[model samples]
Each structure stands twice: as structure tokens, then as C-alpha cells.
Target: MIIEIKVPSPGESITEVEIGSWLVEDGAVVAKDQEIAEVESDKATLTIVASEGGKIEIKAEEGEAVEVGAVVCTIDTSVEAPAAPAEPKEKEEAPEEEKEKPEAKAAEEKKSVPESSEHDKVKVTSVAKEMMKEHDLSLDDVINGLKRLGKKEVEAVVNAPQATAAAIPQKEATRDEERQRMSSLRRKLSARLISVKNETAMLTTFNEIDMSYVMDMRKKYQQKFVDIHGFKVGFMSFFTKAVATAMDFHPMVNAQIDGEEIVMPQFVDVGIAVSTPKGLMVPIVRNAESKSIPAIELEIKELAEKARNKKITVEELQGGTFTITNGGVFGSLLSTPILNPPQSGILGMHNIVERPVAVNGQVVIRPMMYVALSYDHRIIDGKDSVGFLVKLKELLENPERLFTGGKDAGELMLGI
Candidate 1:
């Protein structure tokens, strides 16, 4: 019987997809449920698997665009996959007399070659040595096989300087160019970025935060946190928590504009922008405002791993109210991140550096980082954008404030 393998729908409203690559060759035997090919859509890359164990005949070529329910391949279930060969059993020990004869033969072969200094200095690549051994040829036989001595070879030796013979060789120059077709994911990403710039009234506000408190907290409780949570705490979790908490006071930063009215979500679903080989993917962390730091870290790690491995689903990439992107991982000092469409705000994190600043009327050094908040200015005003960043700075500078609803611990305790 022949079974057809069709392309699965990646998500809603996606009609066509490009064949990313074929994991197996044409007419190759595949096992049941084995992944045979990868399909790239505008949102994510998904795999096509075999339904039964058999020989597969590919119908769709790589890089070809096919419909959502098109048959990309067919499997001949009548032809079963080849079985694995059995392992060999242990062999009986050889006689001492037989073992000595092989060693004696090696000694005789060793004595046939001359022991000279010139031969000692000759370098042989591992591949060349292996080939010579397989052919039962000696170094002398290889040397004699090179019957011609060209002018270029003689000039290399005679024109050599007296200093060292290990001077680097000059490479020949050539002009070459190559081009490749962009995948569906990349093309979609380009279009979305351009649309975001043209459609929204985007504005960016910048601020600096003294990272001494967060750094000190991580250094102090990292081990204990890891021991209990099974993963180390990271700076992104702190920033995510801060953003979620700060949104409580300045809700407009998280609100988005509908056709005729502004829509506000009661819960915060923070999107973490992860860079992958295909393109940038934002996996939403649901209800981030209600989760703890450790829980957030573990979920981020799992979601990032899935995205990079091309195992994430389209549902995992949708329904995010806000996004946070860290350019610090790439050593970027500062960047005004572009807004993800339909979402009003995005926070950009930059690298931390030790800089001099005034503290208590004294000049001191502290670890500081620059943060940028880019929001749609149509619904968000300068006061809300600036105040949102100030609230984030307060939460991150005093990380304990995150636990107390973005208020100082003393102030909360004293009811001030």
C-alpha cells in the first residue's frame, strides 16, 4: 500500500509554505513517525513525518512552495525497512605462536626502509599515511612516485630567505559572488518590520539604571536559587518582572489602540524576543505578572530552546501584550528596539559597564545599564512613557520592590 504524506497547517490564515529542506534522500527507507522533511512558513518551521515504515518517494522539491494540504511525499508500505545486522560474538584467543609471527612480519617490514635524517623530517598527513598503509606502500615508494620537479618548486627553495622557512604564503586573489533565495520566514519578517515603521507613531524614551542592587542580589542568592529551582536566575527575568510590575502604575504603556477605541488587557503576557537561525521569534510568557522569578526563568529557557531547535508551535508565538528584547547578549551598548505590531511597548536592555557617577555628593563608580522603551505615541504620551521607565528603574534598582508591588519595603511596612 502507498501512503501519502501531506503538509500540516502551521497556523490559521497561512495558505502556502516553502519546503525548507529534505532530511532524507529520495527513495530512502524511512521509519514510522520519523521526520522526513522540514517546511518553512511565514511564522515558523514545521516538520513532515512518515506515517508508516517504508521506502519514500519525494514529490515536492526543496525550496518549492506548496499548499497547506498538498502531498509532499508518498511511502510504499509494502517495502519494509532493512533490519539491523546482528553484532558479532567474542572470538577465541589466538595461539602465542600465531601472534609472534605478525610482530615478526612488522619488524621485517620496518628494516626494509633506510633510517635517514631526510626521511625523518618529511611530514605526512594522516589521510596520506592511511592511504599508504592500506596500499602496503612505504615512504620511499611515495617519494619516487613524484617523477617530475617543476621550475616553481625549484624557485621556492633557491629564493628562500636565510632567516626562517616558515614565512606565510601569499594567497591568489579572485572575484567571486554567490546568491541565495530568501526563505518565507525571512521575507515575512522584512515585510512586518517595514509595516511597523510606516503604520505606527513610534517614539523611544531612554533611561539609565544603577545595576548594583540586582548584581549583588544575584551574586548572593544565585546558588541558593539554583539549588531550589534547578536553574540559575538571569537578568532578563528581573527586567521582565520589573516591566510587569511597572505596568500596574502606568497601564497605558501596555494598552493598544483598536479601530475606534483603546483596548486594555487585565493580564500581562510578556514576549521575550529570541534570535534563531531562521529569524527572530517572540515566545509569550503567559500571565507573567502572577509568576515568580524562578518560574519565569525556567519557562524562558525551555521556550528559547524549543524556538532555536525549530520545535516551537505557532500558538506559542502568539498573543503577547508586550515584548522585551536584550541587545546586551550581543554586546550592544544601546539600541532603540522596533515595536512588535499590535503591541504598543517594547523594552530594550543594553550592556552594563562600570562608570563614575555622583552618589551622596561623592564621586563613585557603579555598574550601570541603559534601557529604552519604545511605544506607540498615538495612545501613549510623553508623561506615561517617561513615567513607565522611571517605575522600571525603581523596581530594578531596588529589586526587593518587585516583591512588594513596586513600592519600597520600608514605605509599605510603615504605610507611607
Candidate 2:
């Protein structure tokens, strides 16, 4: 029986997809549930698997766009698999010819001699001449030395590209240009970015946080935290926890504008913007307000890995109340991150640099990171945006609140 393999829906709004690449060749035998092709949609790339074990017949070529539910290939389950071919048997009567192979191979590998006119004045030794003759080498193969020619020198010259490459001057290659079609995800990203700019009243507010506390905390308790949680404590966890807590005080930043109504969420679901090879994917951490720092760190790490490997699901990419993107990993000093559609706010974290600052009226060098919050002005006012960042700054600058509601760090660290 032949079964048709149709393109599966990648996401809610996705209707068509371009065949990214066929994992199996036409007429190739594939096992059930084996990936046969990757379908690229506007949102994500999905793998199409063989429904049952069979010989596959590709109906759609790679790079061709096919609508959802359209047949991409057919599997012929009725045909039996072909038998493996037998290996060749070794011959037994080749000892004599094998002995002469070394001499023949040496002759083939020997380099060509220079013109006789070039080395006529150079004296050739009898032993060197015989050795060169046996190896099909020449006088040019011998390097000039204070002593007589040697067999080793002749062998080195023969191994050098036979002097053919050295004899000719090669031309330098010119730069060439090649073009490829835009991926559905990239195209969609471009359109959505433009739509976001035109449709929303976006405003950016910036603040600087002293990272000394977090750095010191991580340095002192990182090993202990890892010993208990199996993962190191990171700055993102602190920032995520801070954002979740700050949202309660500034609920407007955690709200989105739907049509004419402003929808405020009861729980904090923070989206982490992960940069993947395919494109940027934002996967949400649901109920981040309730999750522990170690739990948030583990979930973020897993989600980021899945996004990078193209293993993230459509459900994972949906419904984020707010987003947090760290351009710091790529050394971005400062950047105003754009909104991830419908969401009212996004926070951008940048690289930390040591700079001289006034602490208690004294100049001191401290690690500082610039943070920016871009929010929709439609529902969030300028005061709310600035206040939200200020609150985040206070929490991150003194991050002990994350572990204890403002208690001693030693007690909390010991408890963990």
C-alpha cells in the first residue's frame, strides 16, 4: 500500500511551508517515524516523518513551497526491502606482483628532473645517482649542501608536489557572489518587525545596575548552589526573579493591549529571547513568579538549547506576558530591544564593564551593566516604564531579596 506524506501544520497561522531539505532520497527505504524532510514555515521548521516503513517516492522537491495538507512524498509499504550485497572475496595468488608494486609505486611518485642545462656543472655521486635512478628521481631532486648528495634529500624532493605546482605560477581566485531564497521564518520576522514599529507606541527607558553584589554572590555560593541544584547560579536567574517580583508593583508593564481592552495577567510568564541559527525564538517560562531561581535557570537553559537545536515546539513559543533578552552573551554593550508583539514590555541586558563610580562620596571601580526596558506607551505610561526599571535596578543591585525576603545571606546559603 502506498501512503501519502502531507505537510503538517507548523503553527496556528501558518498555512504553507517551503521544503527546506529532504532527509531521504527518492526511492530510498525509510523506517516508520524516521524523519524524511524538514518543512520550513513562517514561524518554525518542522520535521516530517515517514508514517510507516517503506520505499519513499518524493513528490515535492526541496526549496519548493507546498500548502499545508499537500502531499510531499509517498511511501510504498507493499514493496519488500532490497537485500544487502555480498562483500568481494580476497584473491590468493598475488604475492609475486605485490613485491614489484613498491618499486613501481616509488617510480610513479618520483619528481621530474630539472632541465639538464640547469644542473650540468653540479657533480653527481655514484651512490646518489643509483638511488635516484631506482626511485626515478633526478639531479634537481638533490639540495645543494657542503657535503655530497644523500638518499634522504632525494626522497624529500620527490614528496614535494612533484615540483609541478612550484614550477607554475597560479592565479589568485576572484570573489564570487551567490544568492539564496529568503527562509519563511526570516521573511516573517522582517514583516513582523516592521509591523511592530508601525503599530505600537514603543518607548525605551534605560538604567544602570551595579553587578558587584551578584558577581560576589555567585563567586561565593556558585559551587554550593551547583552541588545542590546541579547547575551554577547565573545572572539571568536573578534578573528573571527580579522582573517577576517587580511586575507585581508595576502590573501595567506586565499587561498587553488586545484591541481596545487591556488584558492583565495574574501570573508572570516571562519570555526569554533565544538566538538560534535559524532565527530568534522566544520561549516563555510559565508562572515564573512561583518558580525558584534554580528552577528558572534550568528551564531557561533547556528552552534555549531546544531553540538552538530546532527542537522547540509551537506551544513553547506562544503566550508570553513579557520578554527578557540578554545581548550580553554576544558582547552587546547596550541595545533597545523591540517588543515581541502584543506584549507590553521587553528588557535588554548588556555586557558588564568595570568603570569608576562614586560610592559613598568616594571614587571606586565597580562592574556596571546597562539595562533598557522598552514598553508600549499605549497602555504603559512613561512614569510606569521608568519606575519599573528603577525597581528592577534596586532588586538586582541588592539581589539578597531573591533568596531571603531581605534577610541574612549566610542563613539562606546554608539552607540550600
Candidate 3:
């Protein structure tokens, strides 16, 4: 029997995808439901798995767009799995000391550095070559060291007519002639960010939160929770819940503008902005108000793993009423978050630092972090924005209120 593997629909509204790479070589006998190829859609990248055990025959080349229902590959289902190739013996193989220096292509093929430049590719870099090397970026990405080369003006490369047939003569590329195709995700992100900068009435409000209580709570429970769940319990869950609480009380902060009208949502679907190997994405948590600390931690763990593996989908990134970004994860002391448009607000979290503060007329040291909320000042007023952030600070200061509220406080806070 022959099995025709077709490109499945990547997501709702995404009808097509580009074949990023093939995991299995042609004529390799693969196990049933084994991943054979990687497909990158506009929103995410997913594996194309073989449905039946067979000798895999690849039909699609890498970097070509394929639509849903298009045949990607075929498998001769009758072929048995090939025996594993024997490892080369030490006596037959040359030692590493005898090996010659690896070329740029060899280094790229090995993927020792993930951000390696494609053949004859150019990358736009801000810093100088000396500065780049100091930052440990010697040869990872093709950050055209044009400045180091003493070139007064550097030009962007455009694709020339590529050699397609074996009969066609391959042209030796000049140092000045190379093409750099932008990834689909990068293009979309660029357009979205540019639109946000242009269209929205955006403004950022800032405040700092005392980390004393939350830090103490984590120091106490982190070990226990990690032992129980085999994962470290962190401050993100606590902050996520606190944001939810604040959003519940201040609906305008959690909503978006539909032209002349305001679109208000009753539930808090918090979008946590995660930076993946590919790009930045905001995957949302539905009804975050109901999730416990443990639940939030687990979901965060799973989502982060998915993001790293490029397994998150477009649907997962859509419909976020608000967004939360942790610049602290990248060791950021403080930053004003760029508001994710359609949604009115985005919260930026900074690293915790020991700072002096007045407590009851006495100065003392406390672990403090600066938090900034960038919102559309058009709908979310200065008072409500300040009030919402104040509520966030109160929740972080006293986390036990999440478990228990003072009589009417529960209804008021939760909108129950």
C-alpha cells in the first residue's frame, strides 16, 4: 500500500504553510505516526507526521509554500524498517585531531550555533564587530560586519535569478550580491508593531511593587511545589493572578477599542508574551481568574515548552483581552512595554532589586520591582489606570486575599 501524506490545515484562517525542513531523509523507513517534516505557518511551526510505517519518500522541498490538502510526501507502506547502520569503528575512522578546519557551511550544517547565517546571507546589526565579539556573537548570525570592513555604505541584497536546473550554470556570487528573505512571522510582527505605534493613542504609566510578601511566599513554597510537581514554583503565577484581580475590578484596562465603540469583556483572558527561538508571541490563558497558583505554574511551563519547540498555534495567540510581558526574564531592570494593540494594555515586569523604602516613618531594605502598564489613554483614564495598578500592588503585598476576601470584597474583586 502507498500512503500519501498531505499538508494538513495549520489553523483556522491559515490555509497554507511553507515547508521549513524535512526531518526524515527520502527512502528512510519510518515508524507509524513518526514526524517526517516541519511546516512553518504564519503563526506557528508544526511537525508533519507519517500516518503509517513505511519507507518515506519526500515530495516537497524546503522553503516552498504548500496549501492544505496538497500532497507533501508518499510512503511505500509495504517496505520494512531498515536495519540500523553500524557505527564506524575507531580503527576505520580518522581522529578529530587529523580533521581539517570546518568551513562556514560545515559550521552551519552542524548547527552548533542556531542563529548561523545562511549561505551568502547578510544580517543588520547595531553594534560594531568588536562589541559583537565581546557579546559572544562572533559567527552565529550573519551580522554583516560592514563597518569593520571599512565600507562607507552597506546595501541590502536582492535575490538574483536562482539556478533551478542541473543544466543551468551556477553563478559565483559576488560579496555584494546576496539575498535575505524575511521570515513570515517576522514580517507580520513588524507590521503589527508599526501599526500599534502609528494608530493607537498609547501611553505608559509606571509604579513599583514591594516584593517582600511574594518573595517570602515563594521561598517557603517553591521547594515543596517543585518536589510535588517536578517543577519550580515562581512569582509569575502570583503576578498573573494579581493582574487578573486588578482587571476584574477595572474592566476598561482589560478591553479594546472597536473604532468609535468600546468592547468590554467580563472574563480576563491574560496573554503572556513569550519570546521563542523564532519570534515573540503572546499565548493566552482563558478565564485566568479561576486558576490557582499551581495550575497557572503548570500551564506556563507547558506553554513555554511549546513555544521553545515552536508547537504553539495561531488560535493560542489570538483573543487576548490584555497582555503581560516579563522583561525580568531577560535581566531587564526596567522597560516601558509596547502596548499590544486591539487590547488597551500591556504590563511590563522588571527584575527585583533591594531598594530602600520608608515603612511607618522608618527606612528599611525590601526586595522591590518596578512595574509599568502601557495602556490606551483614550479609554483607560489616569485615575482608573492608577487605581488598577494600585490594586495589583495590594494583591502582591497581601496574596492571601486571593484565597479569602473581607465579606463584600470577594464580590467586588471577582465580580461574582
Candidate 3 lDDT over residue span 154-205, tens digit each: 3322244455798678898876867855566767788989998898888888
What would the per-residue lDDT of candidate 2 be over residues 42-72, giving only the tens digit for each residue? 7777789988988999999888999999999
After superposing candidate 2 on the true structure, give the runs of residues whose Cα lies further than 4 Å from its correct spot. 77-175, 403-416
The lDDT for every candidate, in the order shown, is: 0.91, 0.86, 0.81
Q: List the residue pairs that clash in candidate 1.
A: none
Q: Report model 1's TM-score to 2 decimal places.
A: 0.79
How are the candidates ranked when ordered by TM-score, highest leading? 1, 2, 3
- Candidate 1 lDDT: 0.91
lDDT of 3: 0.81
Name model 1 segments beyond 4 Å from true: 82-166, 169-172
- For lDDT, candidate 1 versus 3, the one ahead is 1
Clashes of each: 0, 0, 0
Q: After superposition, how far is residue 265 of candidate 3 from its true place, in Å?
A: 0.7
Model 1 weakest 10-residue run by lDDT: 109-118
Where is the poorest 10-residue window by lDDT in model 3? Answer: 149-158
